[model samples]
Target: MKNKLAIIGGGASGLIAAIAAARNNPSLPVTLFERNTRVGKKILVTGNGRCNLTNTDLTEYHYHGEDVGFVSVALSSFGLEKTLEFFADIGLLTKAEGNEIYPYSLQAGTVLDLLRAECDKRSVEILCDQYITSLKKINNQFIINDIAFDSVIVACGGKASPHLGTDGSSYQLLTDFGHTLTELYPVITQIKTETDYVKQLKGIKIEAVAEIVAANLTRTCIGEVLFTEYGLSGPAILDLSRIAATNTQNSPVIHIDTMPEYSRDEITAILTKKANKQNGTLEELLTGILNKRLGQVLLKYAGFDLKYEISLLSYKEIKKISAAIKQFSFKVTGVKGFQNAPVTAGGIRTKDFNNTTMESKLCPGLYATGEILDIDGDCGGWNLQWAWSSGYLAGKSAAEKLKNGDKND
Candidate 1:
């Protein structure tokens, strides 16, 4: 009789892990268990349903963790070319938008469909809504709800978007088995600031430079910035959120350059040149130069009297307004939280696993992959790539071990 291989969760990692296992070892019986009624609920919402599958510019610099270098092993295992080839093998062609890769069909559901079809074709058992709240390892057999499996892969994900099925429910499984889970925080999410200025400028979007200053480190990301009733969001915010989330104890401050195109002196010169009250109100001075609402907010915050005509600005006020345009700083109060976060920052510590195989160092025949592991990447397709890369290694290694006749302890 063949021993059964059990995989927990059915997200990106579990799905691909199942495929890799079944495809690599056709004789092995692979079973995936998901608590949700369906799998890939989180994948459906990735990249706004367009599903940024993987990044073309694959590198370790894009990822974050206690040791970002840990991802190199897994990423190099599947690699970018192999990942794209794997997707193509499934009959789903992809297109590259800049460095981000998306399906040719441009629907997240299509990616999920291909993965599910492959699982079905390979006969990988998928048990949906069969959420076993807990499990026990008895003699190298994972006893879950009374059924035993020779091997187990825990890819149940971290505590991001709990509604999609992960509430850190399985984190305890690792801890129970002697794995340490670091602090987890919602990453790649919107940030809230300590200012009422956002209230009036809500819904305004613009191309600006978002900079985060924390722990003696300053990083900048240039992209679209969205002003929300609570604070800031959009590409710029999402890109810098991980850094902010990781350094929250340091009280990170976010600074936005409303006019990144111009230097401080250049802006001051422009203000001096346009300082003509005869033209219109102070608000009118910034017309056509910035978002109407954003310009008004900046003008008001610059300590200039709104009633003052554009041409009547004093030398002191002109310099102050120019400085404000170049650097609109906001104290980051906090992130939008896990509910709004697309993924988490910290999870099961990487030191506890063999980076080469993603198997737990504490347990034999017990593996982990995806966000559940202490690996996260930038807002683009990096996280998904990590999932694919790590899953490939885990599935391949687990099946190979089984085929090599590693007996159940």
Candidate 2:
């Protein structure tokens, strides 16, 4: 008898899993169930709609979780080459910007459309708005809402972007099946800080080095930093947010180096020279060096009067001003939560599942993949790569098991 495969959650992993299963075993009937109005709704928001497909620097260093190295087996099994090849086989033309990969069309919708079309071509049944709340296993066969299946793959995603339909419900489903979850946190999100000045600097974007200081550890990232009313956002903050989210109790502080190009002494010397050369106000001293408002705020923060004459400023005052600009620190309060997070930091533990095949070691015929697993990658298309790799492995492995009539495991 030919086996039937049931895949839960029609997001990135589930969609690719359906395609992989159907291709692995032509006789196996694949059914994809989604809770949202349609599959791949979350894909539309990834990479700001550009959908970063994958990265050339695909390694365990870019990913974070309890056992960051747990991703090795899956990535080695279906690494970046296989992921790009899979997309290319499905007619996806891709382009790379340095290490980041995106579709040639540069539209996330194109990626989704091609994935959905391939699933259709493979005759994978896609049932939209079909939310599976529970699963039952009887004699090694899984049943979802009275429908029996030889194997099941849960790709329900994580708690991030709840509106897109994966609100961390899959954790409970796995819990019912004797699986345990790690402490969940929101990553790739904006951070909230306890500073009133950020309100005044709202909408101001600048390129700087953002560092997180907590637990006696320092993590540094360089990119754009956008000041919001509550705190900070942008590529740099988003990357540093993982540390803030994980180390909230350690009183994490974010130190932004607004002027990364120049040393504190160099900036002080430049300011001293400007103060000696120009008879302008203190604000004019930093006129072309930094944003007018930011300069004013820094002057005030450095205990300097904005209306003070620049030529009359002393060298000691100049050094203080440079210090303030180089190490602007904020006490991190918390993150924006899962709703605003791009990816969740934790999920079902990896030890419960086999890394090579993405199958549950405890429950033989059950599998889990994507953000639903406790493996979350960094920004720049790393998370999606995990989704694709793990999903494909789960799908292909499940099909292989069914082809061998190992359903009664």
Candidate 3:
């Protein structure tokens, strides 16, 4: 007799688990439940519709957790090599742009469609709009939505993006089943600033470096900086926002180096040479060096006379301008919240599940995978890779356990 399996949540993790379990046990009955009308809602929005499937170089260091060793085991079992092969086997050609990997077709919809078609070919039952209100262990069967299954895999995602179907509701469901959950927060989102300069610099973008200065820890990232009406955003600012979101509450201060490639001394040397040779106004001289709007804003902040001749500018004034450009600081009031975050920072505690099989330690015949676990990766393709690897392990493990009639207890 074939074992029956149920996977909850039809997002990336849930869909992957359904396909993996069905593929592993062809004779077994596999059914996937999704709260939304369709599956892969979040997967459709990844990488601005390109879907960064996985990273070429995956390591435990990209994730945040108490037990680093556990993630190491999961990564080692299904790392970048396995992930590449899995996607390629599914008929999706992958290409690497720097460290991030995207489909050769460069369409997120292609990845989602391929996965959906594969599930259909395997004859896996996909139940849409079937929200699992609760789960109960009666006799030896796990009951969900009044349907009994030999084993259940909870691939429901975390609280990061609600519109995509993972709104942290799975946390409450798993907790009811005696699973431990961690404090939930937003990750890979923009930060709000308390300073008024943000308004003046709104919509201005420049290539710069942002540094987060906590009590004892400081981290820096160099990329494009976007000045939003609320505060700062863009890839570089989003990366630093994680540190501020985790450590500071009220409002953390971040220093932005408008020019990271050149030192203050080097900039000053160029400025001195240009100012000595040209009789142009300060604003005109600065226009060639920085954005017109940004240069004006910086000059206003530094209390410099923009209309003055470049040759007449004092040494003290130049030093002040140079310092502001090197150490321009702003206060980060808060993050944009989970609705705008790319991924949830926390979820089910790792200690509550077996690292090898993703089986719940407290509840037998019940397993958790994907974002439901406390493990989360950075902005690139780490989270999706986690979904594929963890979901595959849980689906295969649960199917094997049910096939052998093994006692989960």
Best by lDDT: 2
**lDDT of each model, Cα atoms only?**
0.89, 0.91, 0.83
TM-score for all models, in order of appearance = 0.97, 0.98, 0.96
Question: Where is model 1 more than 4 Å wrong at Cα?
Answer: 276-278
* Candidate 1 per-residue C-alpha lDDT over 66-164 given as tens digits, one digit per residue, 9 for 90 to 100: 988999988887989999999999999999999999998899999999999999999999999888678788877888878888888999899999999
Clashing pairs in 2: none
Evaluation by TM-score, superior candidate among 1 and 3: 1
Mind giving the per-residue lDDT tens digits that candidate 2 earns over 1-409? 5689999999999999999999999889999999988999999888999999899999899999888888998899889999999999999999999899999999999999999999999999999989899898997689987988989999999998898997887788788989999999999899999767788789999999999999887889998999999999999999888889889889999999999999999998888888888986887778898998888888887888888988777788888999999998899999998988889998999988888889998888899999998999999999999999999999999999899887546
Measured on C-alpha atoms, candidate 3 has an lDDT of 0.83
- List, residue by residue over 1-409, the lDDT tens digit for candidate 3: 4568999888787787788788777878999999999989889989999999888778886787656456776677777887788788889998999999999999999999989998998888999998887988888788888888888889889998888887787787789877777777798799887757878889999999998776776778888889989999998887777677887753568899998888998878777777777886777767778888888888777777778778888777787788888888888777889989988877888888888988888888788888888888887898898898888888778877876778656
Q: How close is candidate 1 to the true structure, as a TM-score?
A: 0.97
List clashing residue pairs in candidate 3. Answer: none
